[model samples]
Every structure is written in C-alpha cells, then in structure tokens.
Target: MTADTSMTTVKVTTEARDRLAVLAAEKGQSIGAFISGVAERLPTAAELDERDERTRQALKKFGIALAISERAEGEALWAALDAGDDEALLKDPDA
Candidate 1:
C-alpha cells in the first residue's frame, strides 16, 4: 500500500526492532525514516571511535598489526627530493 522508493528491506531481531522503534519514537519519526536519516548523515566522533575499536578487534582476531618504520637515510633522501636535486635521480635512473 506504500509507495516504493528504491528502498530495501532488512530483517532484525525482536529486541532490535523494539529498540529501533523506541529510538524512532523519541525522534518523532518512523523507524524507516530514522534509519534513512542516519544513513545519510555523517558519522559522529563516537561512531568513528566505535568503528576503530571494532576494526582493532577484528584485526587482532586475524593476528594482524599495522606498523611504520623509517630507514636511517630516509631523511636525507626526502630532503634531496624536496630540494629538487635530481643528481641522485640521474645516478639512479632506473629507480
């Protein structure tokens, strides 16, 4: 009976449905509208923090860690590149 607007259906547990209904009522909007608005809005800092925690947990489960290191000569190389001193580039044309 409602108009279709390229929307998709998702199934949630009874508890989740109840919680969403309560949140929507608090915002004076339907559950569908509340979910749509959240999808369109930018994520908040709290949301980003939660996302980062979830990512860290998932990476830990897979025994993965991201790390960065610099070589001893990295600063000189970067300085040369910044100064546009192409002598090094000429010496190592292949590089």
Candidate 2:
C-alpha cells in the first residue's frame, strides 16, 4: 500500500490524552509513533467488506421476518407490532 504522508489533527479529552501520553512513554515511543502504531492495526478494506456483508445478511433476515409478520390480523398484528416481536409477526396464519 502507498504511504499516507498527509498530516491531520485529532482532538481528544484531556483524560484520554494523559492516558495515551503515559502509555507512549512506557513504550519509549513518541506520541505520534504510538498513535501511528494504533492506527496501523485498524481494519482493512476486506475486513470492512466482510463486516458489511454480515450486517446486510442480518438486515435481510429481519426484513423477511417483518414482512411475514405484516400478514397478521387486527388485534394480533397490533399486539405483535406493539410488543416489537418480529418473529411473532412471521407466525401469521395467512402469511
């Protein structure tokens, strides 16, 4: 990967700053070096893509369950909706 030489400022709480300072000193690294090391460990594109795929699958399953629940009748439908039971909505007889 190409190196990112751009510099940017990040603001954090005083408590967090102090904690990071101590951690950096303990490791015998400059604050910038310590922060850079932490940034380097962040999720890559493939890891983010996998996370997005899992989230999409979960949402698709919930949507299907909600649609099935939409077939419920009168009070039962209202009850399920009020109770926020997506699975109960899927048990509708006419669905």
Model 2 lDDT tens row, 1-95:
23878877889999999999999999999878799988787878788667666765787877833343333354586788789887775784565
Candidates' C-alpha lDDT: 0.72, 0.73
Put down candidate 1 lDDT per residue, 2-35, tens digits, no spaces: 4558877999999999999999999999999988
- Evaluated at residue 6, the lDDT of candidate 2 is 83
Q: What residue runs in model 1 are displaced by over 4 Å at the alpha carbon?
A: 1-4, 44-95
**How well does each candidate superpose onto the true structure, as a TM-score?**
0.40, 0.43
Q: What is the lDDT of residue 63 in candidate 1?
A: 96
Residue-pair clashes per candidate:
0, 1
Model 1 is weakest, by summed lDDT over 10 consecutive residues, at 66-75
